[model samples]
Target chain A: MTWHVVTGGAGFIGANLVRRLVQTGGRVVVVDDLSLGRREHLAGLADTLLLQLDAADAGALAAALRMVPDGPVEVWHLCANSDIQKGVTDPSVDLRATFLTTFAVLEVMRTRNWRRLHFASTSAVYGDHGTTAIHELTPTLPVSNYGAMKLASEAIIRAACETFLDSARVFRFPNVVGLPATHGAILDFTRRLIADPQRLAVLGNGMQQKAYLHVAELVDAMLFIRDHADGPHRIYNIGPEDAGIRISAIAEMVRSRVAPAAAIAYGTEARGWVGDVPRFRYDVSRLKALGWAPRLGSAQAVARAVDEIAQQEFCRYDA
Target chain B: MTWHVVTGGAGFIGANLVRRLVQTGGRVVVVDDLSLGRREHLAGLADTLLLQLDAADAGALAAALRMVPDGPVEVWHLCANSDIQKGVTDPSVDLRATFLTTFAVLEVMRTRNWRRLHFASTSAVYGDHGTTAIHELTPTLPVSNYGAMKLASEAIIRAACETFLDSARVFRFPNVVGLPATHGAILDFTRRLIADPQRLAVLGNGMQQKAYLHVAELVDAMLFIRDHADGPHRIYNIGPEDAGIRISAIAEMVRSRVAPAAAIAYGTEARGWVGDVPRFRYDVSRLKALGWAPRLGSAQAVARAVDEIAQQEFCRYDA
Candidate 1:
């Protein structure tokens, strides 16, 4: 039996991946600092070792890895600062949490002689390369400090895979939304509407479009790529095949759920904020060619997330 | 007059760039930690302000940038851990010297409103892509930690440029060899042969090929690109148009210069070390199209570097 180790395993995507792995009867070990991750997200999982240690700390990471039962180990490196908005305000958040976390994890894996590593990269690595569909090979000219940090981590992982690891896969994820949602447009809209229930403020012109992948489908694609791909180092863009939904559409869905009469006021610029890639498309034909596809497109995924988050928040409010 | 800030100005490439800027009557400020840089490299330079500070320290970098006279500042970011061999032993050296140095410099640039930045990137970012001719758009999959660090820095600079800076150019250098040589095969061979005239132990098969560019030509091309290129973000591969000379050929050239009868013993693998990218080619037509070309091919550059380093070492030996 193989032991799967996940960093940032209490966060949104990491927690979701842990649940999928547990359901398949695999021994799982999760390392999370809980800076942004919630413990309740990983609750009720049987036989899962949740080591509450900062993944950025070298000593703590090594000790946590040692705690796993001696067996074949595969690392799912999903640890990163989830707050892209904060990266705009303070770039150090991305540097210390995202890039440094990756560096610490890679160092541990190198010392422990781990064979395979799966990195959770982001679509932001492409920046706002106009409105063209971006492939895995698109020149990674990141616009934000968050994107830069992720790209830096990707470069390190690629180098380490060649020098030390047996194999590695880097998946560039687009706006992932689902249960236990930490941050994104859907959650932000839901919170804002629940507060005022009248005028909802929208960033940008609300015409900026992008794809969104559900956390469950993201994990499915990750496992599928890991099992099927034989290349020593593989870079795949993970997203839905259909065109992305506009911000206005996502905002409307959120409005319908929380406050249908809320008037939407738009920001001046096309971008939501500094370093925001307002409109871009993902060419995930590489992953599709590998016999994998997302069940929900961007609109459907965002709609589902809005309802789930609204219900979660409403229940908490009622209690 | 515009103020020119050169990071790692006491090192080989940075010193060369400083020399060029000084010749053209530009006010120059040099920042270097002297970890891998030599103070003597900038000795007797006219009116050049030298600040002995680590480029990786954000506060120190900000202070140094503040010290520059109020004027249009264009930063030439060339600071990096020059020793690739050290990276193989410890990856943190590259992480600090290369990536963190760039990050610190960029942060300071962003805060201080320094709009123009010229980054010293490398061909190592291409990794071991066989013998294919690489272009600016070639997939960056660095095989060594040094390469990874450089690539990571490039990603940060790109992001920073899009976010804050006016214009930026990333020059991907390939084996820049010339006077005041800090480290490379030429200088290493010259010292070894000078110490022991009879035997020379070489890493990898002698047939491992790579392109080389004279540092003078590299600086020339960099200035040329800075002046002529109009792209918002420019990435150019700076190298000789000719094919790379083999290690055995360069070794023979060094032996002929210093120790005529030295016997060369080759290593088993095709690469010099674990992170070595033994063979690759740079398609610098992007640069060539910009009305600039290498004055010396790889063979000529290597031969010239061998003579210059041998003379410098011989004078030291005599003293």
Candidate 2:
């Protein structure tokens, strides 16, 4: 019987992961800062320990760890700076939220002699790998501070694995989307259309393309890797087999579902933002070797996510 | 006129770099905390500004930067946790010293609009690459906290370059050894032998082999890279052409020179320390491609370093 500790447990993908872990009859303890994570997301989960505290705070982290029974603990580290754009104004956000949180978590694990760790890294760590499908062995040269911090966190986790951790799994996630989606392009597009039914203003030229894995598929793949993957340290690029869908294609899908009458407009700049990697591709052959693949492609994932988020938000606003 | 800023300037490699910059008639500003740096190392150089401030302190760093004249500024980021062993006891040492210092420097640079940067990274960032001569594209999987912090610093520097800097050079160094030497295997061995000449206990079997670049060669390669390498960001492996010398061989050299009568004893472990990577080889072809090479091989470098350190310490003791 493994006790699962999921940081950022009340956030989007985190909540989905928490639900899956709970459904599997595993004892789950959720540690969240509530800065961006909402408690409402984890509602109705019984016999679960939910500690509202920042993972970067060592004392709070240690206190949260105390709640778990003395046994096999598997850490699913999901806490990170979700607001990638915020890194430009607050450079320390990524460092503190992502890197520091990981350090604190690894330190606690070291002291407690708990070993198994699952880190949620990002494809952004590869920065702009041009048009080539970045393999796990690709030289990670992150351009954004967010990506830099993620890469930093991954390095630390790898170091900890060498030093103390019995096993470690680092999954480089693509743009993940699906139900209970808190943020991203689909959510943003849907919200904008809700605000102005006739006009849809999108950032950049809307040509940016990248893979998107649904949260359900992401969680499923993670579990599959945990059971099957062999390693003291294993890094896998987790995404769909397809190249990915363009932002313009995603916008068309969102507009069709949310506001069919909306006229799409694009920004002058080709990139959405300063640090935005307009194009990225990653090879997921490693994960596929383990017999894991996303059910939906990038465009399909975006369409489904737009619908899910639209339904949830519209029902709330209507009520 | 080029105005140079070298963080950790009073320390070993930093001091060597400052000397070269001063010789070139550049206005050099050195920021050091004196935590491990000795002011005596920079005694002969005149017209050089030495600020007793930690690079990690944002306020102090900004205050120190104000003293420098408004001109062409090139930052040589060498400030780091000199003690790799210290990371084991205080896990935060490398993070605060190495990673935070780089972050603070980059922030200051970004704010001041400083465009040129030279970051002193380490080959330890490559971790245990087995016996292969690791290229610049070698997958970075740092095993030590020190190595992880260095890798983190490189990632941050690269990110900062992409965001702000016009040009950046990231030099991944091997075990650099030379005069005014503050720390490392040679200094440790010499001090231990000086304290007790009769019995010398070596860490591990000391089959631990690694490359050693002389401080002079390292400084030379850096300047060469700065002049020849063109890039928004360029990463070069700075070391000798030949594969490195083993710890046992280094121990034998030190024993013969410092204490011929000392009985050598070995630790049970194969590695010197917990995070110690026993064997690592890096290809210097990248640096060599630019017509740069180390004058001394690994064994020769170690022997010369042992002599230089031996003479410096013995003279002080005699006085």
Candidate 3:
């Protein structure tokens, strides 16, 4: 039987991916530090082994892999420093969490002769391309340390594929939303409303806009790309076709669901934080070419995510 | 007085750059680990201080910068794992030497408020583009670990510039040749012929071709770019406008200068090594537009380098 190895597997998107993978009846090995990923996320999942360790530690990752029975192994490299703001504050965070994790995973794969790899990259790699539609071929001039490390990881992965790896797929994700939310605007807004339901203090001017994809749709596209992508190395920008919903719109969605009377206040700065690309447009034609499309648009995804997160966070109060 | 900080000042190109900086009457701080760089390379340079330490150590680098007297500082980051094959053997070599060094330098610069940085990037970052004339805007997809790390460094440097840096100039150098050669085809051929003058063993099939630039010309272009370039970040492909000279031709040039009687034996593989790009075309229009050009073509650079290296290596016989 094939083993699906998901780094950061118990985290938000990783957890969603793990849940899907488990349903497919494949034995899964989850490697996560659990800094943000909770053990409860994968509570009912069977045939799953949770290895709590830093994914960037090669020896630890290698040791974890050794415990798995020898078979066809595929790695879903979803582990990374999810907080872009933290990375801006300390560049080493992304260097270790994002870049080093990818390097360690690739090295381990090279040593063990494991081939298939699905990498979770980010749209930030394109940096601030303004309104220009960013495709897979867009020049990656990252503005943030988070994007820089992701681009670095992509470069190394490409090199590995060129030399030793059988194949690798790099999925450049836009803002991914939905379930088991660790950190993001949706989660942050929801938490803030829960703490102080009278006012929703939004970062930036609330005009910042970018594509969004639900975690379920993201997982589906990933699995679709893996099944369909036929190349040594492939890059796909996975996001909705629309330009995206604004932060103000997302703020309204969260505010209405969490606290209808909450006054929305926005920061004067156009960007939320340092190294934040306020706006971007993703041209995911390559992924669309493979006959895969998101069921929900950016607004729909945001709306659905807000509902999911509000319920999840509010449930704690009811308990 | 303005100070020039060269991270790899004891190495080949760094030494040459240091000499030029010294001639301009600026104080120079030479930071090198001396693993591959030699102290003798920067011999007799005036107003220069040598700090022997790995460039990747952020604390050490920060401490070294503190020792230098306060002044207008410019960093020429040239230190990296020069041996592509070594990096292919062990990826961490380039990770620490190339990528981490850039990160460390950027962090130190950010802390010290040192704004200006002239980075020594590589054609390797362009990877195996085949015969496509690579421009500064070329989508970089590096095929080797050396290239991967360089590309990674470039990404981080770009991010730094976007965030805290005043300005940065990234010079993507081709095969740099000429005096005090540490490693390359010319140096390798010269040493091999000196050991066994009967037969010259080549790594790859003789047809592999790529642009070459003399260290003198490379240094000249770097200074030229520093004086001319503006904005937060700039990248220039520094090389001859011509496609390049073949490796077979380089072999012949080396053999003629080092050992005229030596028979050349070629390996079947087109690439010189595992990570070798083998062939590439550089469109140096970007550098040329700035009114800078190499004094030597690919063949001329190779020939001149062969003569210089041969003389340097063969001087012991005359003594």
Native contacts recovered, in order, as a fraction for each? Answer: 0.72, 0.70, 0.75
Write candidate 3's Cα lDDT for A105-219 as tens digits.
9998888878999999999988998889999878889999999999999999988886678889999998999988889999999999888989988889999998999999999
Residue pairs with backbone overlap in model 2: none
DockQ of model 2 vs. true complex:
0.79
What value does the lDDT take at residue B283 in candidate 3?
Answer: 95
Using lDDT as the measure, name the better of candidate 1 and candidate 3: 3
lDDT (tens digit, per residue) of candidate 3 on B1-319: 7898899999999999999999989899999999989999888888998999998999999987898766569999999999888888889999999889999999999888888899999998877888889998788889888899998998988888767788889999999999898888889888999999999999989999989998899999999999998888999999998999999999898888878999999999988877788888999988888899887899888888888888898885678
Off by over 4 Å in 1: none
Question: Candidate 2: global Cα-lDDT?
Answer: 0.88
lDDT of 2 by residue, A1-319 (tens): 6699999999988999999998998888899998888999899997567899999998779976887877679999999988888885678998899889999999888878889999999998888877999999999898888888989999988888777899999989999998787888988898899899999999999988888888888999889999899979999999988889899998888889889999999987768986788988879998888888888988777778878888987987799
Name the better of 1 and 2 by TM-score: 2
Give DockQ per model, in order: 0.76, 0.79, 0.78
After superposition on all C-alphas, the RMSD of every candidate to the true structure, in Å, is 1.5, 1.2, 1.2
Query: What RMSD does model 2 have?
Result: 1.2
